[model samples]
Target: MTNETFRALVVEEVNEEIQAGVKACTLEDLSAGDTLIKTSYSGINYKDALATIKNGGVIRSYPMIPGVDAVGEVMETTSDSFKKGDKVVITGNGLGVSHTGGFSEIVRIPNEWVVKLPEGLTEKEAATIGTAGITAVESINELERNGLSDKKARILVTGATGGVGSIAIAMLKSLGYENITALSRKKNEDFLYALGATKVISLDEFMPEKIKPLQKQEYDFVLDTIGGKVLSAILPQINYGGAITLCGNASGIKLETTVLPFILRGIKMLGVDSVQLPNEKKEAIWERIANELDKERLSTIGAVEEPIDRIEEIVTHLLEGTHSGRTLIKM
Candidate 1:
């Protein structure tokens, strides 16, 4: 495979600008790693969309491949943990940020970053879950550990139309959670309902004229993907002893809330990060995701499938927030 070439979407600095397009690459062009994978499918993530734009702050280097999660089969390896023909999945761990990523027909990555595809999960299913699914599952896991045990708890998920929030809703429903509310900027009530949201609230309805330090308590648990004012407004409305798992900042990064919720309500706010988790933890969460999640409901999470060539258009839709659910890239 020395002289073999494959197609990849490369982001390079061209005359002080970021230019991304499909280009031919060789195995030699990839970074040295113990495992070489033939990518079957990859997912389009927010970070991957950002990495293509100029000064998006996702990629620190030019000529990078920007796919954060990939599901594929091992084609070659120098690591004892894996051998040729082994199916695997890779996500986070600097996959698309500091290293060459999954937007290619092939990817050579460190063996430590790889996880064997658990039984009962297809390549498309694994790729559909991708990084967004992992984040959603991890956030739920943290909430469960911190006292979100009531299956009938009133749960609210922000950014409901997005990948993480949609999957979170589906997973929660599959886990037997009764009441789930979705907050979205778009009018996709039916879409949210199909994903098991008991009710869908618009941003306008959710945000009032002003947010008080301690508003009426409503939610038992919140899977917050939109931070900034959304998070600020939500902090005061959490029921006493409830928990909130924050994993995204699509709104903004600032928080202007008082500590009354924490002091008086005894609520817990947990931050979930899927990117830097240890490989063993990732494997465990993935195993739970595979074993515990309903396959039919999980299958509904990925809404679109297109060849890798159509990535740029989907990226544009994702960046514009016009797209919903997950988009899979067939390689």
Candidate 2:
């Protein structure tokens, strides 16, 4: 691939607005780093899609590649952690946000951001899982911290139709958490059931007649991707000594609620930040996701492979909440 130019979805912000296009550049145009990778695949998350909007979604600067998750072979490396041709995966840790991300055929990132792609996961699969996998594993770890058990306590996953929600459900099922309830806006009940959801409730059904400070005891473990009233509503439903992991603020970051869930029910609210997780904990969680996560089931849940140039349209779908599952960008 010497002297060959490749396609990349480059986004530029003008007057505090975002503009995206299929920009072309040589490998030399990539940012300076320890390793240069020929990115085979990258995953499009909400952040990546936001980059194509009128302003920066995750990108801190304009004229930057916008992709948070990528996995490919090393083309060059200066660090001992990796050598040329080493296969690896990367995500989060300010990748698409503050760094020259993974939207192109080539990427340059610190060797510390690189980790050998875990056994049993392909470049495509790793991109499909992306930061969503890390957040799911981290959420479960928090659940375990609060004594999550399989002894009849129900587990509730909100935004069950989303990438993170889908993977979390499968992980819970693999861990023998069968009593799982899924809440989604989609009418595809069978899809949720197939993904190991014991019960599927439409968003309409989930809305309570009256959201009280506390409600009848319910879920022991909760993985929420949508924040706002949905999160506030779920708190009242959490069982005594239960735990909830807050991963995304997609619905809204502004939370207004009383502390009755903590004081009266003794519930634990854990925050998950896959983007800035400590390097050591991130590595441990990545290993767990690679080892314990069912590869077959992960693919079954969702993995859409589209050309990198189609990023403009994908962003609109994701922000509109019309997309489902993980969307992979084939570089």
Candidate 3:
């Protein structure tokens, strides 16, 4: 392991097909970064799965590492922000998409993208509450607490079984939001309950209840992961002045909706792109997740701490929609 060469999941395009596998590579050949990390953990994300398949176009260059989350100890550093042996977590900031990412034994990244492992979190804990956890926390926080009613506010979280959705349920529960509905495939009902979902509804069951450009005001706030039609369908149902933090496109990328929700109902659709958010904002969210997101709940939401090999399997399963909950990749 001490050798200059280490194993990595390399994604290369061949004859119009993107192929990925574990290969040996040297540190000098890795992506450019100001600091080096002896990766202790990482997570399998949807974007990582895209890198291994043809037509995803996730990798800007060939022979790329396709993982977005990394948590580890600093091995070397040129930036004053971190030192050797310091624990840290990283996600997004063009990580697996462009920069060589956490799918390898080691990762070198810009110091600014790093968040020092805050109190109340370990390498495994940080990875479980990786970008997904942070995104949920940030989305929940986007609602300004300006003397607004707390528990009385209704919140709906869609795609509750996915990484972001599950964590959002836990976060809202911890923050005292009780009138919450979690939408997911019926098979994940038990899993959503374990993650503190008060009410779990089948994605299939919820659909076809009613469809309208504007319906009865229901949820005060909505956290939509299954965007596209789901969002188009839910937007009009949101209570006037309510907000929906748009996160993922798991349902569909193309949005088909009218301005009825935005104009007629005075609804809001806040786009949350975890990949390109400010580094400082991400660092703040990581710290808040450590402090406020509640560790006990995070672990209960299917946190698996395993060696890096698990990441390869996790990424594969994620693409197939088989991997359930969060996977913390330990190196």
Candidate number with greatest lDDT? 1
Where does candidate 2 clash, by residue pair? 17-54, 18-54, 18-55
Clashes of each: 0, 3, 0
Candidate 2, 1-331: lDDT as tens digits: 5588988877776676666788788866677688889899988887777766664346666678778888999998888877899898888877877777888889889888887887777888778778888888789888888888764669999888788898898888777786989988785677778778899998888888778888888888899988888898899889888999999877777776789999988999999888877778877887888788877678678688899768888888888988888888887
**Superposed Cα deviation of residue 321, candidate 3 (Å):** 2.6
- Which is the leading candidate under TM-score? 1
Per-residue alpha-carbon lDDT of model 3 for 38-87, expressed as tens digits? Answer: 88877776777777787775787887887888889999889887799999
Pull out the clashing pairs in model 1.
none
Question: Against the hidden reference, what TM-scores do the models get?
Answer: 0.97, 0.95, 0.94
Candidate 3: misplaced stretches above 4 Å?
1-3, 145-149, 310-313
Give the clash count for model 1: 0
Candidate 3 weakest ten by summed lDDT: 141-150
By TM-score rank, best first, the candidates go 1, 2, 3
Candidate lDDT scores, in order, read 0.90, 0.82, 0.80
Q: Give the Cα error of residue 260 in candidate 3, in Å.
A: 1.4
Model 3 clash pairs are none
What local lDDT score does residue 20 receive in model 1, on the 0 to 100 scale?
A: 91
